[model samples]
Target: MKKVMFTGGGSAGHVTVNMALMPLFLNEGWSVEYVGSAQGIERELVGSLDEVNYFPISTGKLRRYLDIQNMKDPFKIAKGVYQAYRLIRKQKPQVLFSKGGFVSVPVVIGAWLNKVPVIIHESDITPGLANRISIPMASAVCTTFPETAEQISKDKTHYVGAVIRQELKQGNRDRGRNYCGFHKNKPVLLIMGGSLGARKINEAVRAALPALTENFQIVHLCGKGQLDPSIGVPGYKQYEYINEELPDVLAMSDMVISRAGSNSIFEFLSLQKPMLLIPLTKQQSRGDQILNARSFEKAGYCRVLEEDGLNDASLVSGVMEVYNKRDEFIGRMRNNKHSDALSAVFRLIKETAKHP
Candidate 1:
């Protein structure tokens, strides 16, 4: 059987694309394996899969700021690379596909050292630190945004657009409403701040609930242990995080207020959910979320609300504005012609793989 190794982790954004594509490879009689940090969200997401083997590696955080961990991290990364190199050699996968993250950097380098072909997927408008470092070692770079091609070699970049999970489209709206105990008379709004949840977003949304729930029923994914049981508001339901019920919840949602993670925003875009995006501040990140939000705003897919200006009042106003202009956003989203990204990416990986 043809063999493939996938690497990416640290965040759900890094691993989601791999999760979307793995089943395709499995169905085609390929042996699919994953390499990621053991304690990361990727381990839980990929390890649960029965068909794919999961390999844990010692990965260090690739932080930009100065810290004591910086001194120790290089050694950890070096150890990870060695471990990855040996694993890749033993597994002898036909190709290595990386969805850029800190863990992926070592895996990509190991694949390069072993003379194995590597394909990378970049979801943001600009490459992340991990992808930027690994791009030179990759056989091809697949991009979600057309503009991303400018940063990489013309010959190596392939614009495949967003790869959406098929399960998301198969959600049942009624099931979602029943789960949330929300009536269909009022519009449903989903508030999510990535997988880990955003403290600011959760606080702001909770503070604005009196104003928001008067117009829209809300389902809030407040991250793990972030839910406040003290807030007993009608037409509002809160969960620490969602899993199997996510698609159903999304299906019932008429609009969204979320952090500007590329994978999530694209899913919202694909579902034509009018959105108000509050991207993480530059202080909190590399300013990628800011760029992601701006790109969506530019395309008329959503409205951007930076975290610096976020407050209960602003949150309420933003949601009101998006709710009123929801039709316009929906119209524009419907007009967008999404390419078959899953097919294109699958084809790219197959073509890039070496014939055994």
Candidate 2:
């Protein structure tokens, strides 16, 4: 059977697109293997799948800030690169597919050393540190946004939009309402702060619960270890995280309030969900979320409420505005012809693997 290896980690965003592509590759009779850090969330997610070989490798985070860890990280990264080089030489996979993350850098370099062709996908408007490092080594780079393609070498860059999980489109609204104990009479509001949760967004939403619950039933995914037991109001429900039930909940939601991660916003666009986006500020991140939010707002798929203006009152008003203008937002989202790019991505993978 043909074989391909996937490498990505650090956050769920880096791994989700891989998950969307894996099943398609498997059904086509390719042997799938994964390379990631031993202790990352990717281990649990990828290891649970049948037939996919999971290989754990040493990894060190790439941080822009100064710290003692920075001094030691270079050595760790060097060791990781050597270990990945040996693994790639031994596995001899036909091609290496990478979703950019700190862990992916070593793997991409190792693949280059082994003379294995590599393909990478970047989900942001601009390349992250990892992708910037991996781009020159990759045979091709796939991007979610057209503007992102312009930033890279035209010969290698492909603007293929986003890959959304197929199961997301199979959600049942009735099942979603039952899962959240919500009635069909009122509009449902879904608030998510990515996988790790956003403290500012959570705090503001909790503070505005009383006013919010009056008009809309809410389902809040508050991230791991961030759930509060004190707020058990009638129309509001809280969860640390939801996996299988996520599609249902999304199906039942009339409006969404979320962080502006590219993978998530594209999923919302595909679902035609109107959103109120509160992006992570420069203080918290490299301002990628802010850029992602601005792009979505410009496209009319969502409304942006900056972190500086995210108090309870503003949170309530922003959500109300999204709810009121939902139709317009949905109309704009429906016009996104490139919302589902799985087919294009799959074709590229096949073509790349054939030469490799």
Best by lDDT: 1
lDDT of 1 at 165: 85
lDDT of 1 by residue, 1-356 (tens): 89999999987889889999999999999999999997988998887689999999999989989899999999999999999999999999999999988999999999999999999999998899999999999889999998999889989999999999888888999999999998879999999988888999998898898899889999999887798999899999999877679899999999999999898999999999999999989898888889999999999999888888899999999999999999999999999998899999999889878542
Candidate 2 has which clashing residue pairs, if any? none
Residues 73-133 of candidate 2 have per-residue lDDT tens digits of 8888898899999999998999999998899999999999999999999999989999999
lDDT value, candidate 2, whole model: 0.90
TM-score of each: 0.97, 0.96
- Local distance difference test scores for all models: 0.92, 0.90
- Candidate 1 local distance difference test against the native: 0.92
TM-score of 2: 0.96
Best by TM-score: 1
Residues forming the 10-long window of minimal summed lDDT in candidate 2:
333-342
- TM-score of candidate 1 on Cα atoms, chains taken together: 0.97
